[model samples]
Target: MRKLFFYTKQQFFNFKAMQTAAGFKLLSMSQLLSSQKVGELNKNQKYYVDLSSVMGYTKTNDSQQMLFEQLFDSFGENIDFICDKMYEEDIKYIFRYIFDDFSDVDAASEEIIAEKETIIETPSRKRRIVDLNDKELDDFFKVFDASLYGHERFKEEFKKLVTAYRVFNKIGEHKILSLFLMGDSGVGKTEVARAIHKALGSRTKLAKVNFGNYSSHDALNSLIGSPLGYIGSDGGELLKRIQESDVGLILIDEFEKADSAVFNYFLDVLENGKVVNSQADEYDVNGYIIVFTSNITKENFRSKVSPELRSRFDYKGMFNLLTDTDKKKYVHFRVNQIISKYKEFVSEDIPDGLHDRVVCEVDVSKYKNMRDLNKKIKDTFVKLIGA
Candidate 1:
């Protein structure tokens, strides 16, 4: 009969010592029991079995206790069962009842001792987001109002969305708030997400997935991933971007450009508030706000998007071109920003009247598109600075 080994939780994760001592790789109990036969070992070879998963299984199914005992016995001398100290008594009793000379091996080998001195440390992968207290939520609204310009109706609706999300997050069935914005290009459709990210005080880049780049046949695979056992099957661009971001907001720009597969995938995501990659790993986006920006017209939107998907959006609104007054405000904001940056870095003093001069130079009436307005501001700034 093989002796059962009890390890501390710390020791179980120390792969080098465990692998060398057992003369085989370590595997969780679930992996060993799974139907996949890719890495199956022969009868004579030994393997280290992680008992944590076994403990969880046996706790749920009292009837499986006898079956697991029989299966462990069948592995015979080829398996070394490794478990944490808390499960020692249960494991000991199960082994003693099945085998006559069940005992634990307590002696530490010289190799294990040496390997312990050089234990490989793994970096933690814990994700953290900026959490707002009640006081902070009020401050968040103040910042949001100042940063986002124009579209007063949408702004009011967004505030209501945030308030509802905070109040009902714990009890509501819907876990995510999804907004669909459709309008002409440069109408601040994408800016809505930028404003929210800034209001959250996020220092990291906003999580963005542009569907304009994913119009191919395998767009779903490129967005999530190919299935396991296939090439390039790692968590795809969307997951990677989300993991890198500090805020719980995702921007899908040019949303109408994606294939139907991508649309269906997102419908499932909006419904469940979770995204499952092709590898079967799931990411929780419970408190997230996903904004979809599109250039599709109202008529095309109804025709292109299915009714089921269209109905899932929490708010669907068309963003209009910024009013002339809003454009003037944006011009003043941009000029001030440029002047502030120049004052901070340049040794030469900028003229006190430079902002007014630059704003006057930019004829806002000539430009309806925000992108074109922004270009004019940049051009005027350069000309004034050079003069």
Candidate 2:
């Protein structure tokens, strides 16, 4: 049986899981080192070490190298190692010097085959709505429509584009459906992604990356990860989130804030339907939906975005603020939903007309931002409940 194991950074897709057993013990490199010093280590115990957290690899230490040799020699079996790709060279050193049987697992092992079959491979996975047939898609759209409170015009345009995309997709003409939504804050822009995620029956959260927090100089590096082999380098947050999600939708929020490097990166992603990280690891995003939401005005959009990049968007729709009537309807729905939850959780009695009372207090015309309207609803509910 193979005794040495290395959990690569790619495997930590926003979630790392392990099962604890009676003989199994999880340790950081430091903890293992401490155990080595005390001579308390037991060969009967299974060891899992997160070697990535060992920062002592700053320079080659002869004592540490000898310790590793002695440590493993003490317990030859049942050892799991983790290496953040930053220290692949060091892990390789250990692999060559210590374990000659296999690198990560036995050559042509079933475990490696299963890992390749599941994680980071696009072909093995099913595309959510893209895999849906005509009748199935129609049903999905209905659920998507009801999930959002407003944006009727954008919804209609989306339905048409999706239908056209489905036909083009079959012929290999269209690789992905792109939506470039321009809007003010709090106008159901990101909600489009959430709705699609829910409608697609994904139990995981929507895959999303917001460029607003990134500076122009470092945006590309952060998006795809810093160039490989850099200290603390790993597969990027974007790819990890995509791997974590079970759906085909990806949301890029605050799109205009990202620099041209990021823009060009995505332009290629849109064109090729494959996201290649700095490490040259490819993630195929074909048959996926990529939604880009930006708050830049029409004038600024034309000025900030290049024409070549502009032409790549399949649908560029401006999301308008909800109408007062729609806002009122939203308030009513929220109130009823909140009251039902309150009843379920708190088991409290409420006035028969409490929903109406809460709804009437929220004046939708006074707030243009749906987020502000939502806050008002919550405040009103709390006040009425306290009364």
Candidate 3:
């Protein structure tokens, strides 16, 4: 009963915190809307959002959308109830409504502030991007270390990254620190990209893209939008996202499998620090750090490319191979995680020396190393349980 009450209180506190946050946001939104000049909108624009329809739903939208200017204005102070309900569609609708109202109002201070906050609150950064300064860079590295299990060499490479940043800053030029990270699969190349996204202090970033997906014209078009009269409209997914963020990271995995045409697109970005669109305009890529990963070797790549094409990348480094001790550590680490996860699912104590038996019994040679050990265990579990 005490634990239940404690949990209830914790939930209450969380709700209260969320309420306060929503209240502040609503207040800010209100202030911004009122302060901006909506120009002829107040007299001419017909509000298209349906307020009664939104309220009929049981929840408020996390998307923070509202229709009708009067609706937002009237309920500005009471928006906490709306945001607290996780009604994303409603929130997005209302948000776009508010933005539309502000944009019609001449997109003044209120509109700018509203859009800026909306961008910041988005899962990806929208625009007016900022880069990590030296002190923030240090904090970023610190968090990167804390997020992972083990990678002493990764930490060392990160220090080299700090030096790289300093070099870029001193040169008064904005160009990517291009890196080619080659290693065995699941050895943390992907994880490192995620860490950089979390650490780099940039509002705009992406960590990974598989080269195999870029086979069709639509696939390439999906990254950056297509020309007018295209079936559906997107702002060009990857390219626009990167441009809007200003400073971001792009982690391209399995580069060897990407179509040659994709490399043709990338050549300009690597050499000139710009991505040219179909419209003939250029997006500055100097603000980005592009990391490409592949299992292919230099000889194979050279065979595939001309000498001029090979010269585009700035830095290339091999991912470190795991040692025998490292492999053992990974095995034990995974075993502990599995035990902890399933301990509650089973009522009785685990079978005597079962973990040890499993670890000791598996034929390690059928797969690569520690990474395979976990896969083998998972496969074994699936076979036994029909999972």
Candidate 4:
């Protein structure tokens, strides 16, 4: 059986030596037809190459793709394809067109070697959950509980989870605290991350990635960065956001909308407790909280996501619509905040009844989502101030 060499760019030196020792010639797709030097090839000789590097999923011209196809048709049997950090299906997609007698479903054997890890270290502002002291952790929880309305049960569960995580994490047991929140849209699903960000006392934006935009065929490239140095050659949105944030929290919005490649990539992140970006920069997220929010129901969550991934979550809970009482409390809290801001910025001569009058204009039962309720509160404030 012929062995198809699959190695990462980090292990290129080993692959180059091993392939050259054999009869196979090592040639890039660019060097195959584009190079000026022409050499006569012996019949039945083998060659190692990256087929999709020049003939990529996107951006490669029709003429270039046709050239690769013709090259494959001529040397399909005489070629041992080299895959650089690419999935097997992607490699097969290129081969599907050339070989009509393609019977090797799983013939590509991965070359397993000791990988030399490449890390791009930057001065990062990393304050992990494990770093917080007792009083500081209490302060964080206080802010977290106050910022998010309702979910009393979830808050209690989260407190217990964190208390245990702190102990286990200190002993090198637990790595990451992951939450899979399944709920309806606008039901304060993302509010969990916002509350955590506020509680962390960060002076910067929250680290968030909306997977709705990552549902494309090349979603993985956009997320972790494209190989061969496209836009995300520096490690995609995930690494960039993590690097920029001071807090040890990551919010992945619309989790169910992401591609399977993304799902597989995150599986590794959760298992390893570190993010190795496309540029090979290694960032430790051991004490981080990665919150994944999805609008999918309990049934879909089971049928859609894989079981291996489903078991990795520390907590999976559903968020319900805020009760009328909770909503009223939120309205009051928001109005009081607006009044406080107005007094500090615009005028401190506001009457005491102004708070109650503003709250009275709004009916919480009219809205299902907190966003709409917030909008109603804003409109009432504007109208009352105009009067």
Clashes of 3: 18
Candidate 4 yields a Cα-based lDDT of: 0.73
| Pairwise lDDT winner, candidates 3 and 4 | 4
| C-alpha TM-score for every candidate | 0.65, 0.67, 0.52, 0.67
Q: Deviation in angstroms for 195 in model 3?
A: 3.6
Clashes of each: 0, 0, 18, 0
Model 1, span 1-387: residue lDDT tens: 565566664444443332432234455677666323313443434466767667766766778776666666446465666667788777666556553443333334556645633432211121112246665566556556656668889989988877776666658666788899999998888888887786665556889999788766878898888989996578888888887776688999998988789889999999898878887877888778899999999999999999989998989999999999988877866676566556557844876567779888888889878999999999988888888
lDDT by residue for model 2 over 1-387, one digit each (tens)?
Answer: 233454454444311321121123455676656545435543434556666665456345655666666555554445666556566666666545665543341122345445544653354364466788766677568668766888888889888898889889879999999989898999989888887876665656779999888887898888889886799887787888888887788999999989989888888988999988888888888899998999999989999998888999998888899998888767766676677568758966986667778877888899998888889999999999988
Q: What is the C-alpha lDDT of each candidate?
A: 0.72, 0.73, 0.51, 0.73
lDDT of 3 by residue, 1-387 (tens): 000001122233332322222111112122223323222122211122222234334244433333334444543221322222333444444445343221111112434444655656342343211355555566556556643435677668767865765577458564666667667676666656666665553434564567666765555565556765767755565555554442367888887776666677677677777766554555665556677887777677777655665676755556665555555555554554455446536643666544565566555445454456678876654343332
| Pairs with steric clashes in candidate 4 | none
Q: Ten residues in a row with the worst lDDT in model 4? A: 112-121
| TM-score, ranked from best to worst | 2, 4, 1, 3
lDDT of 4 by residue, 162-234 (tens): 9999999889999899999999988998998888887776545788999888656867877778786575365
| Global fold similarity of model 1 (TM-score) | 0.65
Q: Which one is best on TM-score?
A: 2
What is the TM-score (0 to 1) of candidate 2? 0.67
